[model samples]
Target: MKDSFVAEDLMDLALANLAWFDGEDAGDDSGLGCNRDYRDLRGKTWADVRRVLECERRLVADFRAGEWVPDEPGDGPEVEDLELGVASVVTALSALGCIPFTSCNGRAFGGEHDADALIVGFYARPKHWRKLVDLGRGSRTELQVWDGALWLQARTTEDMLRWAERAVERAGPSASHPSLM
Candidate 1:
């Protein structure tokens, strides 16, 4: 369950996340010192992203090569939750300039094939839940945003996006301003 996004845009999206973090700390306008932290960390952040991407490529290649040792301790959903799916989604969303406050695509503790939910903390508009339901996407995409931030538990990426399109639209343009995170 991944969303399409431009890798080059990740830096800006990261800045957006940092800015949101700033908003949480200083009740003094997010615009004040938002970009400062980002400017200083850009190079390091870029390098980190590159390193992770390279390692991910290697991991995938190893798996494809049938060299994935099943004897590894955490080679199950619990680890996948951290090492793959969640990381991938986080990165994808970051590229879109929408940072999740916190999230979890639930996993059965030991690869029991019982993984059964997805959680996302996003920013959305009022009455957006109704719109999602009307779109028929809410049946699988649960939404709650009563207190300025949207929290969701979508069953599928498709379902998530169906509601997100409307939510983002209602929030207005500027991808960096897309989240309350």
Candidate 2:
């Protein structure tokens, strides 16, 4: 059985993951004060990361608002500033109350998968559990269980986009902000 979790829990988890990098060094010069390893985030807080990444504030707000319009271009996080292809998937998952900790656009160093695949690591709420199962079953990609989270692998950027679309559809209308209920 899938464990139940609330949107607040996911928000806290995302915040914690961003906070975890506050103390580390860049390790390499990838220009964002952080290397490809996600260290030395320019500013101290997740808020800084969001700003530097040019993340659309409304998307983050939508996570809590529990309402999102998928594939609306500017409605989601800015992909150009994100780690390539996984941004859409991550944004979709976040809208569905999932906390993504890691992701890759399937570059040469992307672990396990080929250089063309896209992957994301996240924690999902129980309410969205069935959708995950359905995605894994219907897609040409792979969704695997990890120690404390889940990993999704898609063969191409379009595949990930399709997965995101399906997820939002399966979830139907988003619920209200967690605090409102």
Query: For model 1, how does the per-residue alpha-carbon lDDT over 1-181 read when each residue is reduced to its tens digit?
Result: 2232222322232222222333444333333232221211111122233334445445545655767744544353222233332333333333334434455545411232224655555332332333433433333455444334444555653444344344434334444332332
How does model 2 score by TM-score? Answer: 0.47
Model 1's TM-score against the true structure = 0.35
* Poorest lDDT segment (10 consecutive residues) of candidate 1: 35-44
RMSD to the hidden true structure, all candidates: 12.1, 12.4
lDDT of 2: 0.48
Alpha-carbon runs more than 4 Å astray in model 1: 1-83, 108-116, 123-143, 156-181
TM-scores of the models, in the given order?
0.35, 0.47
Assess candidate 1 and give its lDDT. Answer: 0.38
Model 2 Cα shift for residue 71 (angstroms): 26
Candidate 2 Cα deviation (angstroms), residue 157: 1.2
